[model samples]
Target: MSVLRINVILFGIGNIGSALINQVLESQQFFREKRNIDLRFPIITNSTLAFFEKEGVKNAWEANFDQLAIPFTIEGIIEFAQNKGLENVIAVDATASSELVKHYIPLIQNGFNIVAVNQNANVLHIDFYKEIRRNLKKFDKTFLYETNIEAGIPVLKLISDLYYSGEKITKIRGVFSDSLSYVFNRFSSEDVPFSKILNDAEKRGLLKKDFRDELSGVEVAKKLLVLARELGKNTEFLDIKISSLFYDDLEGTNLKSKFYFDADILDKYLEIAKITQVKNEVLRYVGEISIADEKLEVKLISEPITSAIGQLKGSETVFEIYTESHGNVPIIVHGDSSRKKTTTIARGILTDILKVAEKIKIKETVWL
Candidate 1:
């Protein structure tokens, strides 16, 4: 049996990216011996610097990347892959940069499979999204973005599977952001103020560098748009009506230093919580999309503790799927949504990489 060598070109060396590298290295021998495949990373990069080795980067490449990696552009990296005539290449995008995402189509044009952890590229305009799918079909390439919707859970795959099986998805609803989940879950269970809970989540590195991205409900809206678009709804980000948990003017304020200074700003949530408590309900930030009505929304709602959305604990994300087959009962997909530690998200990326590899192997066998 001949071993297949799948070259990986990774973008971003942050938590998830670094964890993916270590994971690939850790599983290198196991995959080689058992699966008859060699997973090799020829390029690893951050925002400013990149490490490249045509012969495949060794385990100690991190030290070399730190000491000798050079500056690189998107074009430069693609040209290097072109010059090397790399085959069975998989482009792994772990960055959140919109600029990096712009290179996805070009990468596909060059015969590279894609596994993206970032959601920005997938939630583009409907035309661009269609173009991406068209390009993937035109080039005979695979693009897997299982980690985009929720970090670890296979929500996208579940939807795709259901759709392919002729099950019509009538409505998709869930809590998308684990950061907001932790905030609201704690706010309801504990006696802490909403502002204090938000501060604690920031301190725990649950929120993004820009705290507004999480609290503003924009990120959850993007996830909902991606899900809606995947369900064959021709919807864009603007289509989703997001009811943010924070005040509108909180964007320009110095949230980093004065996060706890303005406790009264979060009083609205506390007031709602108190009212909900009286009604025997819990507060949760929920994302919902009605496929039949062509509606999408992400908002904070109050529900009984026994409800699917209210039973969530910590930063776990829960997706309730309503289909023609399962009307009142929903197919629930629930798990931790926190990407700070990188275990689940990294595993999701690795699963995508392996899936691509398996496809390549099957194609090779068919060719033989």
Candidate 2:
């Protein structure tokens, strides 16, 4: 029997990666039999090294790590992918690093499809985003990052599909940052120290140690930029007005720092919400895009709310998309909602892509 094959390159092997790898292995037969697709994770990488197997990586690639060896580096990964004649390759950036973004431009330009869980690349300078998009257009490759904002949420896919289907979106808003939502909701009732909460969360693997990306609202802003781009608007990161709750000194620092929020700030906000009789009110960091009379407004809304934002449990994300056709669509997508979730999302996106490709191929063959 002839086998259908799809090549996969993975950039991280942490918790999410492990979960994803397990899922892929468990679902391998289902994919082949049900979807008529055979997916293979040929390359697994980390910051320092990578493991490549042309015969297809075993599900236990990391086991007995001493004997099975491969040098891990960005250059090595790129070289291996090119050498393997791996067309329609799926690059999973589970590393959550901005450095991987540069590799994407070249990969996309070379006809590689990428499914990333990394939000850093999308949040970078507008020029970088544009360059990647241009390369994607030039090579006709797919760059799927639906996991960036909300894992397994289909947020980006929904937005892109709606826009392409001629549906007009008037506003975009939701609980964008799981970390911030977690922290705020946890401390809404008490005068807990921000530093302590960050430490506890990180130690528990609930939040990234580098909390700036989540606290500075840059992550939320980046997701908004992606949505805007999908909506046919030319937007940059700076275009979004983020009302960051943390001070500038907190920027780029790990969560282990001794930074604490002003008790007064927390107290005042809490008191106001209480006096206003808002039940379950908690501070939620939001980025919004609204269109009124053909004029678009893109800004961040830092408000105390009683909705999903304030009520987000654990690391789940709930977002709402309002369109002319769909009206109000509420999407609730959950995962580890940590670094682990990001990696899983990347894997899920890759699996989804292979399934989609299989369907397309089947349709084309039938038509022919």
Candidate 3:
């Protein structure tokens, strides 16, 4: 029996990170017995502090908080991993920090595989993306980020598989925000205030306090950037225009004002519905990149029921990928409509990584 163990370094021990740790611990036995793979959570770190154990990390490390002592800096993490003489190290970033990208290149150069759940790194400047790719090529390591986009949706794999099979994607469009979807879906039914729905969502842990990223369409823009990159199109987040539903002054408002304010763009849509004769005037933030003329459009769509985006429900993200051979086909990916769903997507990425790792013969690619 081969007792092979893979050491994993996890960053950001927040809600998403905690869920991922739990899933890893729960599946350890099954993974070891079935796949001959023993996963070890040796180094766990956050922005403030870190904890290291050669033996597997405790599942409830976060609950204890102070007892587990380790260094916190980026250098500290790298030094600890190196000193341990860890053969196989994987860095999982769930923080959504752009700074994490700066750390990944060196880690990969040292032959550590990086799997980032932080979409910021992948979605930002094309130069950064090219640099990361260059580093991956130099070190002969894998850089997989399946969880950066849709949670628990194998959207990346689906696109890659199709592309590899010689399918040409002509146009891509989607409804890609759980928070916005939840807000709009509720707005359509109850005639409730947009701010009220947002407040409710925040209290329920469905939306963040400052949900500008999700509501402003920046989150969806990142997803589209990743998709465009994979399809051999060099694109950046700024290159794609985003239609924001959030008010510029939203950051200044207190929780009390959020319920009373009519600053949100969705509020205008609702007001229009009340006064105008427009039926089923639903609001959806959409991102599209068409290959025909290489045109990219990102805007909030408010149209009739028969329109492509007039029927979005709570936290359900629908994607349409138009290819030369497949034509227009819709792929619907749904989630829990909460922060917890982000963790689910993180877990899904881990699952996909494991599957990919299992397929690569160590003997053939001794460098990996």
Could you say which candidate leads in TM-score?
1
- Backbone clashes in model 1, listed as residue pairs: none
> lDDT tens string, model 2, 267-313?
45444644464444565556677755423332333344555555566
Candidate 3 has which clashing residue pairs, if any?
Answer: none
The backbone clash count of each candidate, in order, is 0, 2, 0
Candidate 1, TM-score vs. the true structure? 0.94
C-alpha RMSD of each candidate structure in angstroms: 2.0, 4.2, 3.3
For candidate 3, give the lDDT of residue 122: 77
Worst window of 10 by summed lDDT in candidate 1? 250-259
Q: Which of candidates 1 and 2 is the stronger one according to lDDT? A: 1
Q: Of the candidates shown, which would achieve the greatest lDDT relative to the real structure?
A: 1
Q: Give the alpha carbon lDDT tens digit for every residue of 155-180 in model 1.
A: 89999999989999899888888888
Candidate 2: count of backbone clashes, pairs at least 3 residues apart or interchain = 2
Scored by lDDT, model 1 comes in at 0.84
Better of 1 and 3 by TM-score: 1
Cα shift from native, residue 106, model 1 (Å): 1.4
